[model samples]
Target: MTVQPIIFFPDQRLKQICAPVIEFDNALRTLTVDLLDTLRAAPGIGITAPHIGINQRVVLLDLPQSNMPEIYINPEITWLSDNKKQNEEGSISMPGISAPVERSVTIRFCYTDLYGKEHTEEADGLRSICLQHEIDQLNGIFWIQRLSALRRTRLLTRYKNI
Candidate 1:
């Protein structure tokens, strides 16, 4: 597997809802590997298939706490806590700019692994934020959409300058 070029912001593909991964095969495994490589190259903690222009519900997160990258396919949020917290968020697709976005402080989500095994997990803090952010990408909601209009405009202006 090789690192693929990231699809930059404003790309229509980034806004298109990704199709669920129906098959668990070599192709899916390769895509996961490529995603991991690209995420590492982008030096990002998390990335979605759409970030690389793939219309598939796949995400890879390489958090420092994990021994290796974690892959999630067809992930969906199952529960969100009433508590909220703000964290700086950015995207590999939209490099160079980030804005603080408020998200549920705790969340429960379900996803399929590369082997097609379904799993549910709970997260809090940065992990909670990352899961929600990447899941948004899968649903065709770019992270910026979570920002206020003024904040989004300012972030886009800064991105343009970069």
Candidate 2:
């Protein structure tokens, strides 16, 4: 149960893109476990390796509706629906800050599992929103960037007071 420290927002590392995981070894497994512990500690539904300053393209999602946590190594969105949906999105990096962000209604993505098995899956609703959010983090895009300039400023001000 290693709950790694999360890198908070405004940190340049959070905006830096992560490198793909090349070795699916014990270290990778350990990192995934640490990520889960950190996510649970943060009380967030999703997290990425970069959140902990690892700079690896790994994501762990434990949605409330999920039976178990899912790991996505080097995850990438392969397709997106034309339709869009607005959902409240936030990040563990910036706790106590949240805003409604528009995202694709459905998404098809591919990722490598812990065992190095490649898999593709499609998701919608909250699951879809989460996947896209985490992937964006992996790509060095903070969730707040999806917001409009005015809304982002207001959210930042609120976060500053928190």
Candidate 3:
């Protein structure tokens, strides 16, 4: 397992649409390990393949290390709760910043595991937020995109100066 470098926000690779997982084999096993190591070293809860400059539909997420980390491969959201909550969300890409953003309190998703087995799971709390946040990466989006126009503008300006 290797700790991959995370590409910060404003990096062009972050915006690229990722490729789907194919040829699930030993290569994938290594990729998953690298992703997990990278996320842990990021000391972050989640990471998308593109963040490491690999345009593939994969992500790694672990909440504070207490919770077992989850790996999602070609993952898709299946359902969500109407209930929403705002939390102070941060990302390695953003460096030293975080902002409150609204997210669904519950979500259901499906994905193929490294062994090529399909699985579906429901998540809530930080897991919910993590899934939504990570799923957004599949579509080339960041949580900041969900912020209000005023807040988005302000954040952009703040980061620009940073």
TM-score on alpha carbons, each prediction: 0.98, 0.98, 0.93
Error of 1 at 132 (Å): 0.2
Clashes of each: 0, 0, 0
Which is the leading candidate under lDDT?
2
lDDT of 1: 0.93
Q: What order do candidates take by TM-score, descending? A: 2, 1, 3
Off by over 4 Å in 2: none
Clashes of 2: 0
Model 2 TM-score is: 0.98
Give the higher-TM-score candidate: 1 or 3: 1
**Stretches > 4 Å off in candidate 3:** 65-67
